[model samples]
Target: RYWPRFPRPKTVLTVKEVPTVDAAFVLQSVAGLAAKAALRGGNRDMVWYPIGHPAYLRWHEEMLRQTRANEQVLPDVWAVVEHFRRAGIVKGYVLFRKDAGDRRLHQRGAYDPSANVATVLAARLGAVMVSEDIEHEARARGLQRLADARGLTEEQCYEHWAAQCSDSVLALVDPRVPHCRAEAIALDAFVLATHGPLLERALARIRPDSPILGWGAGDEFQLTEPVSRWALWQSATNWCLNLPVLSTEQVGSTFPASSIRARQRSLWDLTWEDGVHYTSFLMTDGDNVQWLMGDFQFGAQRSWWNSPVRGKFPMGWGACLADLAQLCPYALRNLIRTASPRDDRVLMGGGYYYPDLFGKSRNSLEPLRLHARRIRGYLRLTGTSLLHMNAAKWDSPEAIRAYTVFAEEIPELQAILMVQYAPYTAGKGRVLWVRRRDGTELPVISARFAIWAHSPFPDDGPPAEIAAKLNAEPRLAEPATSDAENRSQPAEVPGFSWVTVHCWSWFKNAPDDAAAGAEETDQATAAASGAKRGLEPVAWCVRRLDPHVRVVTPTELALLMNLRLRPEQTLRRAVAELHLRLRTAQPARRSAARGFLDKAREALVKRNYRQAFLAGKNAARVLGVMP
Candidate 1:
């Protein structure tokens, strides 16, 4: 699935005055318009670059100067009227108006209706949709071209398009409905109802078994702007790939890709030693490409990526490589090009389509295999092996078994950096092994701690606090001990501990911090108005750690854990322990354990050790042997 030669834009059009209501709508429509024009021109013609974000603008300028020096540059570009006009693609405009009584509806989940309607119309009619507030601005900025070319008034042109779309516009979800009391539930229902059919229709147009893009559903709280921006990118991506966009929600039950592929190559060559607490830090939430293209690209995250201390330590960036390859190949290539060797590694973020919500049934392994294939394909393309995955239910053995498929299918996939958000979950700070057919083990290491706004661990707190917490964790402090009562067996070979530091929150400058030094403080303030936070906090935490702890890249951490752990013996012992527990377990627990045990034995017979371990582990959980 790697592009031998990525598509490059012949011209770059900069959209200024961004993040405003009017510009948001224009930004939403321009990419699709450019895409339609590209179809006529037989090449990727232009890149619709949005400005007004100082950090992003600076990054964009640097990237362009570095990558596409010879490409034509057009500054202060707007409306994209000429592209659409030349292509004769814009039939008319779909006018969306905010409710008079609820002017702020667009900011809330209610705006999803208009957003979905615009996406459907953009795909079907080559139509441009804009909010009523931007109608005048759009016209004066060249949207009037359609009306002038047709010798029709703007009102008449709008009416003509409106008549064609009478059945296309979706009605807003009524929050007053009895079952829609909660905002989250209402938003889910709204997306399912409004965007569901449109997405289904689009999917039907593509081959069922072909790989489709999983562009996530936009942010629900602020639906209007984000969805509008996504709609533009979605349209362009749809045209470029000739494939439909599936939300993580939509693909949870049944992912439809026939196979996923990436280039396979060695990323790094490193050796590991024992008697050290090996820690790897991973930056999280890169599964969402929209976030990558929006905030992560042009927002405060730019500063984080550009931090002077970035390459000084081993940091893993969780990135959606498949999406980047399709939407922003240049940025993806540049990111890999600029990465520090042996220190910075771009791990596959969320496994192609972010399988947190994927079904855990034995049958789901088919989709899981396809998903891993996609991740493996991209890993080969990017020359990396570690996969960082988020699980909705990481505590269950069935979930772990599903994940084992990645290690089973892709030998290149050395380890999985697993994270779960559920409260009181017991999987953290432990390493689960999947024994390969050749008797080798692949390690699945759970996050020891996380830096996230909503996480229980230190989020915005001082680095010293997190350092203290890490030093106190029993798993990191000493070798594992046998737990006979709980059936938690000791590591067959000990002396090494793996700690993964997961970060979901961006760094922000603290104004009161005298420790940042005057020069660093001034730089932060100037770069992003004090909104940006660099990797200094991570560096600080590592520096404050106990002397025995050694920071390593995720790749090295996996290698060390694999070398020390005895996968076959550990899994066999776990299964035997679960059988013993079943004797005294309650009837309900015994019944569940019996079923999972049967599956485990079956998988073992087939030499599917990964699945067997997961099934056995699940059985143990049922009998209260494993957490």
Candidate 2:
């Protein structure tokens, strides 16, 4: 609901003085999500309202001019509306003011609750309009002071009959109003949100040429210390790709404290004075979990808003809404019934989009398998994810024995080791590792091997219910991670010179039987000895591999993913391929293996695969292609 007081703009085309927005990009974003959502097979229906055009206004004026005029328009309008209504869809419209309150939330300004106008617009338009009454407050106090900045006022003066209110057949809203579209899009259904901040922001990062609907990302946005302005772009995406908003009642408990991001610590309600808490920022939505991430299902995986950054920052509009639309319903359902839907945290739900997703490869330090689309990252199996375990386990006799053996043998056996005794939960787990034909371990990792958690929290993810029943299976864990669990990396990773990840205190814990043992139980005795055992600067061997087969850089991976690179991508992969061959000979004869690989790249250019593959094969004695 826009404050009726703001003045109007002549046209988006004419508003060149202000920054001319990417109109095509914006509309493309909305359409991208809508097309995929509509095509998704669901019992749901979708409703779309095309505004900002003279045709719509002419139609509106014709209907409003005469009581009977509405009857004529009703037939065509009802045809479209009835199609959705028959399919059980309840939808609404959002109009662009060309002039909206840009005064950031939490500014001192005029009372902008155009509740009457919202209700009236709903009555006239036959839908419920989202009232911008809430935007007056944000992050802190003395808010709305910049009211005139973005053109917000007490009343939305741009529209006719500005003060009427009604609850009609549709829902009217403005994206600027924080939870306006939240309520609308949160409903479990198919929808097309257009002409609002929701659409604008979602499409902000998209290229106008080609865009896919509902894609995915890990929770990098949430875990990072400081929030990036582009991070808000996630809010736009979550609304566009996720299922309906969750009601507080469904959670039965408060939002988990795991939800509150350190970057959001200073965020508060926007009330200018007491007793005027018109808009609420219940930051600790049940347990302090961030707001949009509360059981929200937005993309192919958890929202990237909650994961760690990789080589290069990922793109927003590049999200595959179409891929998400095609995922199993359980992918969305997992957020509620299964363990933590930690798909990058900010967004939740979504199964593997492809049928042949191989598996994960953790760097052996932590066991959580953080994934984004086809690429998987670290597990939240560190101390913070456990909410227990101090900084002393690495040097314990038990820790030394387990890890040294793990490093040498686990990779040897193609197993991703998961400790069973973290303070967060109970049970031990064992999931074998997956290695590519190239002998590199996959990054999807699991910690189901550890067994000392005292409660039902998933030490390993929910058991492979569907998979084992159908095929001998393996599934990785996705835990709600904490900033505390974030460990520091040693100066070097053991095997790979360029690879490194932070090792945390929670890596290993006492066995259940040992917890009560006299020797291990003596904390005072062990802390001192634990330090001498060589755990002070916890050792780490890590690798931040590009999830793609050959790409070493995230920029290249993002491009491959955007291009829909699939399993076959490996066939055309452009990495340095090495070739070597050797044959045993009689004692007197000498034998040797020769090798060749792609020449080093120059400047900023990536390696050329076609040239490199041929180069490597030339060195092989048996030149016949294996495939």
- Per-residue alpha-carbon lDDT of model 2 for 127-147, expressed as tens digits? 323223322221121211211
lDDT of 1: 0.46
Q: Give the TM-score of each candidate.
A: 0.61, 0.23
Each model's lDDT: 0.46, 0.22
For model 1, how does the per-residue alpha-carbon lDDT over 95-185 read when each residue is reduced to its tens digit?
A: 5543334424223233223443343344444456556666776667556423121222223333334333322112223211111111111
**Which of the numbered candidates is closest to the native, going by highest lDDT?**
1
Count clashing residue pairs in model 2. Answer: 98
Lowest lDDT 10-mer window, candidate 1?
A: 178-187
Model 2, residue 47: distance off in Å is 3.3
